[model samples]
Target: MTKEILYQKFGYVLDDSLINEIINVGVFKSFSKDDIIIDINQPMLYIPLLLKGHIKILREDNEGNELLIYFLEAGETCTMSLTCCMGKSKSKIRAVAEQDSDLIMIPVQKMKEWFHGNESWRNFIIESYQIRFDEMLDAIDSIAFLKMDERLYKYLVNKSMLNESATLLIKHQEIAEDLHTSRVVISRLLKQLENEKKITLGRNKIEVISN
Candidate 1:
């Protein structure tokens, strides 16, 4: 996509000169479905701007179990940028393309330069970090204050916004990991919801039946 188009898509206004600078240092890359875009514990290099498709951020626990953290849609930048900015060598998060995806890789130094030179870009990054920070706080609050059923309900509501039909094609284990609960608890909660006509489960899909 053209620089103007990308800026428009991301809701950022950039001058022609700044756009040219970004284009000079950015490289476009495509990944197939299920491809690993960023591996866990790898050296920080370039920050990715997702132009198309979906990516999932994940990590493995001490028991070697993979946990799902969050999903990134189109027009979102990778969390690696924020982590790297905080002087982290390796990221605990791994990024994988859930579908065939196109991304722009911006060198860290180039981004730093733009961030320093452009007030708008710097504000954008700061706002993005603040939003992520708030989300982390909310997640912690959910874990501490909400019951398993309530947590599952909230997740279903959030996923329903992304998939309007109330059906979510996500794995049960992934839900367990994201909620920091056991798979058995998730299964029981899902079954209870189904019994109450609150939700229905199909192969790899959960449909919320109640509002």
Candidate 2:
């Protein structure tokens, strides 16, 4: 694949030389929706810079239930993966393609190569850590303070935003899995949301009410 997408997606934040370094060393990869890009205990070999679509970051429990950490959109990289890469440790979370997507996978070594020489590269990494840190804090707050119904609503709204559509092509069981709950609870909550004029449900789909 041509590296033009990298220039287009990252041209604003990354300096030309830094972007070219990425182009020279980065491997372009694509993932279909729902593909497992990274799994718990997997070694982090490449740092992924999303070029298209969204990726969902998730944490799995000892029993395999999952809680969504956040979503990575185009122009974003997963900071958790960076941590794992830098430490030479296995991944602690899972990443799944939220939609058909493209990414540039830069080898782990280049992180140190460009960090000091390229101001833009350094800032990008630092800022990504800051951004993801805030998101993690928000995730913690949600778990600590929000009711299940409110959390479900927020999750639906987030999906709608990520897909850039009012309608989400999804299943209740999928939502339950991400929320680390049973499907029956998700179905009941979704119906309650619909009755409250928050959303409308259909077979394997959800339409979030905007007004």
| Global lDDT of each candidate | 0.75, 0.91
Backbone clashes for every candidate come to 0, 0
lDDT of prediction 2:
0.91
Q: Which 10 consecutive positions of candidate 1 have the poorest summed lDDT?
A: 5-14
RMSD (Å) of each candidate, 1 decimal: 2.5, 1.1
Error of 2 at 153 (Å): 0.4
Q: Model 1 reaches what TM-score against the true structure?
A: 0.84
Residue pairs in clash, model 1: none
Give stretches of model 1 more than 4 Å off. Answer: 2-5, 11-16, 85-88
Candidate 2 lDDT over 86-139, as tens digits, reads: 899999999999989999898988987777788888898999999999999988
Q: Pick the candidate with the highest TM-score.
A: 2
Candidate 2 least-lDDT 10 residues: 1-10
